[model samples]
Target: MSEPREITYAQAVREALRQAMQRDPQVFLLGEDIGVYGGAFGVTDGLLDEFGSERVRDTPLSEAVIAGTAIGAAVTGMRPVAEIQFMDFITLAMEQLVLQAAKMRYMFGGKARVPMVLRTPAGSGTGAAAQHSESLEAWFVHVPGLKVVMPSTPYDAKGLLLAAIADDNPVIFIEHKLLYKTKGFVPEEYYTLPLATSEIKRKGKDLTLIATSVLVARALEAATQLAQEGIEIEIIDPRTLKPLDTAAMIQSVCKTGKALVVHEAPMTGGFGGEIVAQLCASEAFDFLDAPIRRLAGLDVPIPYNRELEKRAVPQVADIVREARALVRGEY
Candidate 1:
C-alpha cells in the first residue's frame, strides 16, 4: 500500500547483520578483514565501530579454522555469522563445513544445532579470475544438512540473511560479487523470510524464466525486452537452493507450459540440470509445449580477461535470445 524504501544490496545485508547482532547478544560476526577493512567489498564497513571487535571479530585467513570455530560457538549457544570471503575458497574448509557443521546434528541424533551462517561472495563479473569467481552453491545443495541461500534482490537478501542467522541449522548465504552495488527496495522493519520459499519476480503465461543470484536480474531484464516482442516471460527466483521450492516451480511450469532455467554455473553438473530433472520427474512434464530449456555458463575456468569472463556467464542478451525461442515453441 506504500512505496518501499530503496537501499543498496550491500546496505541491506549490513543492516540485517547489524540488527541481528543488536537484538541478540549471542549473535556475533567473524570474518577476515571484515572489521577494519569493512569486508573485502565493504559490506561490513561500519559494523566493527558499532559492535566492537569482540562481537564483530576479524579472524585469520584460514577458512577451515573460521568455519570450525564458528560451528563450535554455534553449538555452544552463539549465533555466529562467518564470512568465507570467496566461494571459491570453500574448498579450503570442506571438512568443517561438509562433515562437521553439516552432519553434526544428524550424527548426534538431532541433539546438536549448528546455528551458524557462512556468508561469502560468489560468482563472476568482477574479473576476479578462477580462484575468486566460482558459483559453488550446487556443491553444498547436495549435502542434506546444510541450508543453501542465494538472494537475488536487496529485499530478499536482508530478510533471508536474518532468517539464516536465527536458524538452529547451518546456512550457506551466497552473495554474488557483482551484485553488491545493485539497488532495490528493503523495508526498515526487521522480518525473517521463510527458509526455502520461491518468489515470482514477474508473472507471464507464455514462458517461465527461472534464475538465481545475478542471473535473476539478467532474467528480469530479458523479460522486459521480451515483452517488447509480444512475448511475456515469467521470472522465478528460488531464494534458497538446498530446500528448493519445487511446488512453485511446478506450478509455474504448469501454468506457462514452458520452462527456461538459467544460471551462472558451468553446464556440466550445474544446478540447472537438477531443476530440469526435478521438472521431468514431476507431473509438470505433461504441460510442456516444448522441452524444458537450460541456459548456463560455459564449461571453462573463469578468465582474468574482463570481456572473456563476461561472455562466460549467462548475460542479458543470452537470456533474451533464449527466452524468445522458448516462448515461440521453437525449443
Candidate 2:
C-alpha cells in the first residue's frame, strides 16, 4: 500500500485541478474571482500564479455566461472547468447545461462532445443562509447527459475530480463547504477513481448506510457509536450519484438486510428517495428486512440561525437516532 499524507479537502481539489491543467494544456479554468481572487473558497488559490492569467481566466459575475462560454469552449476542442461560486447559484446556468452542454453529443450525432467539468461548493454549516446553502445535486442528476459526483473524503475528491476532468461528457463535481478544511490522508501524486462507482467505507452486518457528500462523515461517526450497542452499521459512499453503483448497494443490502440512505438534501424529493427506489426495483428487494429508512434534511429552507441551520441537516446524533430506530423496528 502506498503511504498517504494528510491534506485538507480544499487542498486536494486544488491539487487535482493543478495536476490536470499541467498534464493537458487544453484544460483551462474560468470563473468569477477564480484567477486573481482564488475562488470563493480559495480552492483555486495560487493557480493564477502557476498557470498564468490566460489559462486561469476570471470572468464577470454571471453564472449563465460562465456556463455558456465554457460549453462553447468545450465543444471547440478545449477542456474547460468552470466554477459556480456556490451550488445554489447554478440555477442561473441550468439553461446552458440542460440544453447545450448536456445534449451537444447527441444533438450532433456523436460528432461533438462537451468535455467540461463544473465544480461548485455545496452544503451548509457556515450559516451562509438559504440562497447560499442548498444541496441541489438531484437537479443535475436528473439531467440525462451529465455525470454527478460528490466526494466525501480528501482522497476521493482528488481522484474523482481527475477522472471527471478527463471524461468526455459533462460532469458536475460537488464539494461540501464544511468538508473544505477537513483533513485526510491523500497521495501526493495524481490518481483517478472510476466514475459511477461506490466504495464501502466501513464494514458491518446490522445495517447498510448509503450516504452522500458530507453525510458520509456523519454516518461514519454514528457507526462508531452504534457499534458499542452491538449494532454494526456498514457505510457506503455512492461518490457518483447518476450512474450509481447499484451492484455494490444491492450486495451490501442483501448482506445487511437493512438500509438507510442519508444526505443533506431535504427529505421531500431528495436523492435518497431515488436510492431507495432503485434498491426496491433490484433483486436486493428480496432481502427480507426492515423497511429502508431515509434520514435527510427537514423539508424547510436552511435558516440563518446557527441552531436552526444545524437542525436543518442530518448530524451525527440524528444518524445514530435514526439507525437505532430502524434496527429496533421502531420506525
Candidate 3:
C-alpha cells in the first residue's frame, strides 16, 4: 500500500462529487453560482467544465426551488445533489425538505425513494454573521426521514459524502466553513463510510469528549493540551447527527466515567442536549464519576464582530477548561 494523499476538505468533497457523477449517470448537481462561478466557496470549481451545464447546473437564487426541484428529480429515478448557498437559507425550503421529501417514502408505503443530497456550509467562522452563519443540524435531526451528516475531516467528508449521494433518502450534508481549508490524508480511490456511525478520533481513559463538526478539531487540540498534564481524554465525533452513534458515546463514557459534550450551535436546543439525555438514560449513567457537562455557543445569534464571534462559540480553551473541571469532579 502507499501513503494516503493530503487534500483540503473542499477538494475532497469535489472529488467525491466528481467520482459519484462519473460512476452513475443519474448523478447531477444543482445550485446557485455553482457553474461558471464555481461556488460560494469554490467547492464546485471546474466541475462545470467537466460535467457541463446539463449536469452541473446553475439554478436561481431560490432555495425553495432548488430543494423542490431536487425532490422532484429524486422521485423520478434521478440522483440529484442540490447545494444551498448557506445552511441558514435552508429555512426557505423547510416545507419541501421536512414535509415532502422526508415523508414521501413513508406516505407512499415505501414506493418512493428520495435519494437526494442537500449540501450546505454551516457554522459561525469567516464572520458571515448571524443570518449566514448558524449550526442548524439539530433542526433537521428532529425530522424523521432526513439523514444529517457533519464530517469533521477531509477523509470523512469525501467518504461520507459518497455514501450520502448513494443513500436512498434525503441527506442533509453540512460542511463547516472552517473545515474547508483544513487538510487531511484521504485516499484517492473511491470509498464510502456508513452513515450514523461514530468515529473515535482519539482514545483515552480519563474522560470522553463527544463533539460534532468544527468542534471536533477543537476537542482534539484540547486533548493534546490536557495530555501534557497527564489527563487523557477520548474524543468521539458523531459524524452523522440524525441517526447518532449513541452506542459508541455510551461505551466511551462507561469506560472513562466522565463525559463532555461540545458543539458550535447555541446551547438552548443544540444536539448536545440530545447526547446528554441519551447518556443519562443509558446504563452509562451508573458509571458516571461526575455530572456530564456541555460547552456550546452562546444562546444569542452569532455575532459578526471577529472577537465577539470567537467568544460566542467554544474554543480550544473552553474545551480544556470544561474537560479539566469534569475530570476533577468540580461539577
- Alpha-carbon RMSD, each predicted model: 1.2, 1.0, 0.8
Relative to the true structure, candidate 3 reaches a TM of 0.99
Question: Candidate 3 — which residues are off by over 4 angstroms?
Answer: none
Question: For residue 184, what is the lDDT in candidate 2?
Answer: 100
lDDT of each: 0.92, 0.94, 0.95
Q: Which stretches of candidate 1 lie over 4 Å from their true place?
A: 1-3
By lDDT, rank the candidates, best first. Answer: 3, 2, 1
- Candidate 3 lDDT over residue span 1-331, tens digit each: 3678999999999999999999999999999999999999999999999999999999998999999999999999999999999999999999999999999999999999999999999998788899999899999999999999999999999999999999999999999999999999999998999997999999999999999999999999999999999999999999999788899999999999999999999999999999999999999999998988999999989988999999999999989999998998886
- lDDT for model 3 comes to 0.95
Candidate 1 vs. true structure, TM-score:
0.98
Scanning candidate 2 in windows of ten residues, the lowest lDDT window is 282-291
Q: Clash number for every model?
A: 0, 0, 0
Tens digits of per-residue lDDT, candidate 2, 109-197, equal: 99998999999999999988999998999988898999999999999999999999999999999999999999999998889999989
* TM-scores for all predictions: 0.98, 0.98, 0.99
Model 2: residues with Cα > 4 Å off, grouped in runs? none
lDDT tens digits by residue: candidate 1, 159-188? 999999998999999999778999998888
